[model samples]
Target: MFNTVLVANRGEIAVRVIRSLRALGIRSVAVYSDADADARHVREADTAVRLGPAEAAKSYLSIPAIVAAAKETGAQAVHPGYGFLAENTAFARACAEAGLVFIGPPPEAIDKMGDKIRAKATVSAAGVPVVPGASDVDIPEGGFAEAAAKVGYPLLLKPSAGGGGKGMRLVHQESELDAAVESARREAKSSFGDDTLLMERFVTTPRHIEIQVLADTHGTVLHLGERECSLQRRHQKIIEEAPSVLLDEATRAKMGAAAAEAARSVGYVGAGTVEFIMSAHNPDEFFFMEMNTRLQVEHPVTEMVTGLDLVSWQVRVAAGEPLGLTQEDVRLDGHAVEARVYAEDPARGFIPTGGTVLAVHEPSGDGVRVDSWMSVGAVVGSNYDPMLAKVIAHGPDRASALQKLDRALADTALLGLGTNIDFLRGLLADEDVRAGKLDTELVDRRLSELISSEVPAGFFVAAAMDRLISLQPTGTVVDPWDIPSGWRLSGPGGITFRLRTGENQAVVRVEGTPSDASVQVDDAEPVRVSARREGDLLEVRRANGVERYRCADGPQRTVWLAREGKSFAFADQEFTLSSRGEAAGAGPVKSPMPGTVLVVKAAEGDVVSAGTPLLVVEAMKMEHTVTAPIDGVVTELSVRVGQQVALDETLAVVSAAEEKQ
Candidate 1:
């Protein structure tokens, strides 16, 4: 066992590795960038080291810096926790050259599997069926059209060097092929420093399944069944489960053997996963997709069913220890499901969101496990992945596990940030998902029905009551005027507050004292309500029933509330009325999030119709186009390509022709 292991990663995976090292009585060292100076992983490790700036190239991906940090800390081994330099063969070799053990497969194995083209070739040579695709590593300019034609339409342009859907583009028509290839190459270069790509047949309604393989220095390899990762958005997995309900015992055995064979062919050691894309129309058929040469973000589901600590095994295998269990000894006990909780908005094209975590209530109980890096007061940023945590549940069967997962998600409370918790719950509750009829395109197809735009009326009521409660004076006073309610002898006695929830505005009127209040939301009938503040929780007793909400007040009359399985933020228009006075109509184009301007599609004096792309902003590695809201002429272009802009900063201004009239 290593006396000290330095983790060359950040976020939840680093924390996970640290916990596993502690369990085995090994000292852990953590490396962090400027953005993660106060991260949970830094606090969890036995010792910590500063890598560099917030940029990945200057920090986590800096091989020399990481190697030096490990050497300075006298770490016997280095663990690359699934991202950053995890699958970098050069980084692994550097650690080995520095006399430090890499807690993963050998550099040779990583090199073979890291490249999608080479990995498919290697696996196919080992008798594993691979998808039919063009394996040409390089394509000359102007040749993409011819190459894409060979692979047929509806194919995928994927970076050969990286995963996580970073450098992937799907094209359904010949017209989209050239642009998709160019975009894929650009993203590939930016993400992996490799412009090489491969074209693969995109199977319609395919199910993503992966087999977890564990290997040792002694050539012992074993498979831990399969995980269904079909529930995905934009080629990234959202929900994953072990012991896929789609696979029968016979199919499972065949896939497991093939995965094991692929591992052995690469001389793989430690934990690696063999991914396959299986057509839903042909249940018994599958093709090799790619192999991830490190621990996966969704490995917990496999651990739950196999009863094995994969991280512990990674360390043991790297230390030249034999895997004690054989193929016959492995047993999958029960069903387990994992939902990735990300700081993203599923309703808004799954855009990444960054904010300070005001509060967090992770679900806990029997059969529920939460692996997270977020806590109250942590600042989520655009420099990294948006994933905040993973909630996993285990049960005796698939149905029970799914039920447990839904309940676990409902109990989760993360305030003051946009998250996919509600979206994940929606996915688990879908009829198609519940019936085990799933595919990679299921979420995208049913996205409209899954994402609810309606905010419950109770939420607005709770927000109103919370704001009113906050206005209470510290001193003990019984006077009605002394309270937040502006009541007078003249006009209506009820005080009306302007609040906005989503796109809907509410005018809430409050009458009577704080203890006994009558509330009327919008134009609805007035309802008598009894409300009391108990610490951070607001208890409201309405005509229907009583409800409790966890509420927190923010600056500028903002209130955040969490109830049931939802978190909402409501802005009070009181401040808007005082400072901004009236709502401004049709302002300039503003950046939604902090990012750099990528493309300026329109210039000053350009006449454009509504919904025309004005400019494109690249933030958090995702591109968002700012479009014209009305048929207008561009009056000013305030931003330039490659210029970084802050959130809400004006990028352009368009004057509507109708406004001029």
Candidate 2:
């Protein structure tokens, strides 16, 4: 085993790799950009190195900087943990040229498997069934239309150079072909520096399953079973599980064999994943999608089921060790499930959110594991991926695993930012999901029912009581006129608070002190309410029952409360008003989230109809298009392409059309 290994990544993956390195008694070196100077991974590693500025192109993705850091730190091996440079063939070759071991596959294997077009051909030649598709190279000039037609409708356009649902589009008809192709090409070029594309037949009812394979320098390859990654949003996997309930033992053996063959065909070594698109209706049929040339985001579930440390094995293999076990020696112990916790708001179309983490409560106990990089005061920005942590649970059976996962999510509390925790719990509780009737489209189909946009009344009551407590005098002597205890000579006295969350606003009224008060929320019947602050937790008692909430005070008089996996930030209405105190109207086009304007579709003074795309704002690799709210002329365009914007900042003004004389 190598004495020192450089982790060429950031966030939770980096932290996870460092953990395994520590377990194996190896000194781990962590690399960070300017944005991650005080990040959790940096604090955990044995040694830290600064790459460059926050911009990924100048830092995390800088091959020379990473190689130099590894050499300077005397790291004999470099582990590209999942994202930035994990699958880059050039990065692999760079490490080799620098005389440092790359703890992954050889450059030739990575080059062959990194490109989806070449991977498909290679796997097919190895007798692994592949999806029917056509790449740009497979067709003659001006033959894209003809090739697409032959592949049939509802086809998928995927970037040949990269994966992760980036630069992918689904065309259901010929009318949408041109626009889809153009958008796919643009995104592909932006994400992978390649505009090459491939077309594939879209499976109507698809279940994404991938086989985890490990190979050694001695040419021994083994499969670690499959993971069900069907629960997805925006074509990205949000929930994943090992030992899929959809596959029987017979089918599992076949898929595992095929995955092993695919790896062998490419001379693959170290850890890799062979992804397959299996039809939900026809369980026996499966098609090869592509092969990831490095460790996967969902590798934890596989590790839980197989009882193997994939990272440790990757290191041993990179050290030219022979296989220590055969295929028959592997075992699937129990079911395991993983839910990705991202800094995103599911209620707002899953847009990426950013803020300072005021508090965090990760779940623990039996059969539970949390890989997280979150810490109090950690600043989450739009410069990197929005994922903050992963909550995984293991159990004797699938039902118990799912139940444990839901309970674990309910115990999670991340304050001062919007997250998908509540949404994940709701998804796990869905009837169809619990029954294992899963498909790639299940989340999309049940999204409306799973998302809860309405703020619970208890939150408002808690906020009111918290405010009432803060207003109490803290000195030994208090002035009568300075007291805000809602005490008066009249029959009844009350104090009202106007709180706003997102676009929704509510007025909460409180009478008396925090220990005993009558609270009314937005014209609702008054209810007896009392609350006490205990450290970061607020215990509130109401007519129904007692509820505990993790609470935190944020900047600009924002009160954050979290309970049962749900988090809400309520800003004081008085402080939320604009400088002029003018009410917002439909004319202002505001950015939905903080990001950079990727494209300006409409110019100033241009007449546009309602729903016309005016600009595209991208953050954390996700793009959200801002559109005209009404039929009007763009009288004021405040933003241009590549300009950074904040949430709710006006990008343009669309004045309503003037009436004719």
Candidate 3:
């Protein structure tokens, strides 16, 4: 094993690699940007090196700087833990030139598989099935329409050198083709510095299955089985599991053998994933999608079933050790499921959210594991991906594992920002999902059903009780009359407090003192309830049962109450919450999340209708269009292209036609 290894990544992946290195008694070095100075990964490493600014280009993606950091820290090996420069052939070659071992496939393998266009051609020539797609050559003037004639409509335009769903778009019609191609190319150039693209026939109903392969210097390659990654949103995998229920024993062996053959064809080494899109309607047929040349984000699911330490093996193989296991030796034991916990709102198109993490409680049990770097007071910004952690569950059978995963998701709680936990819970509870009838479009097809709009009655009750409990005095009170809530003789019939979430508001009434109160939540029958604070927990007693809520109160009267695996935030009206999105008519269009303005589609005084694109803002490595909410005229344009804007900052202002009149 190497004496020291540098983790060329950030956030949870860095922490994960550092943990593995520590287990091997190998010193770990972590590299961070300014945004991650106090990050958990930095704190966990034996030594840390500072990259440049928070921008990924100047920091994590800067190959030269990472190589220099490795050399300076005396790291003998560099582990590119997915994302950033993980699949960059140049980075791997640069590390080799710097005399540092790159803990991944050789540069030749990366060059062949990293480029989607080349990977398809090479794999197809090697007798592996691939998706039908046009190459990365420049499109002729009428080439798109011609290409559509052969490949058919509903094709996918993807950046040849991109992953994680960046710079990819699906076009359903000829009218959408041009714009999709232009946008895909632009995002490709911005993200990967390559404007090259490949057009592929988009699979309508496919199950995304990836085979985890490990190779060594001695050309020993083995497949550790398949993971079902069909639960996706915006082409990004959200839920993944090992030993997919779709594949039979014979089909599993065939797919695994094909994946291993693809690896051997590219002379692959270390940890890599061979991704395939299988027809849900026809489980026997499969097509190669792409190969990720590094450790995957959802590798823990494979780990749980195979009982293999993939990271340690990555290190061992990089140190020129042969893989001890052969094809016959590999076995899949229990079923494992993993859900990605992201800082995003499922109801709002899964747009990235950023804020301080007030509190976090991860699920724990015999079959559950949470891989995370989130901590109280940790700042989640839009500089990178919104994924915060991954919660995984394993059991002897698929049904037991599915149930365990559902329970695990319900037990996990994170506060202080919007998340997709509730959305994931809905997925786990879906009839089709529980039945193992899954495909890539499962979430998107029933997005409305999966998204939650109904707020629980318990949420309001918890909020009202938290407000009353917060009014209690912190110091010792000698007399009962000294308690907070202004207990009076006969005046003040009820203490009314207003609470709002988005457009919904409730006027809660508490008829008695803080300790004992009759709470009427928005004209519902008054319930006799008692509120008491026991340390960080709030106990609320009602007619039927007593509910305990985990509450965290931050400065400015912001309270987060968590119960039954879901968290709700309540702020005292005195401290108004600013709107991060569009306001009412004629108001300013604010930047929803902190990001750089990518394009200004509308100029000042331009007349536009509702849903017309006003500008594009890139954040969390995704582009979101800010459109005109009402038919109006653009009046104030405050931001320029490439300008960095803060959350809720005015990007532009549109005056409604009626308001202007």
lDDT of 1 at 512: 67
Residue 643's lDDT in candidate 1: 91
Which ranges in model 1 have alpha carbons more than 4 Å from their true place? 135-141, 476-481, 486-492, 574-587, 609-612, 657-661
Best by the lDDT measure: 2
RMSD of each: 2.8, 2.2, 2.6
lDDT of residue 636 for candidate 3: 87
Q: After superposition, how far is residue 215 of candidate 3 from its true place, in Å?
A: 0.7
lDDT of 3 by residue, 48-113 (tens): 999999989999999999999999999999999989999999999999999999999999999999
Consecutive 10-residue window with the lowest summed lDDT within model 1? 575-584
The C-alpha stretches of model 3 lying farther than 4 A from their native spots are 477-482, 489-493, 574-586
User: Pick by TM-score: which candidate is best?
Assistant: 2
> Worst 10-residue stretch by lDDT in candidate 2?
575-584
Error of 3 at 29 (Å): 0.6
Native-to-model Cα distance after best TM-score fit, residue 542 in candidate 3, in Å: 1.7
lDDT of 3 at 4: 94
Model 1, global lDDT: 0.87
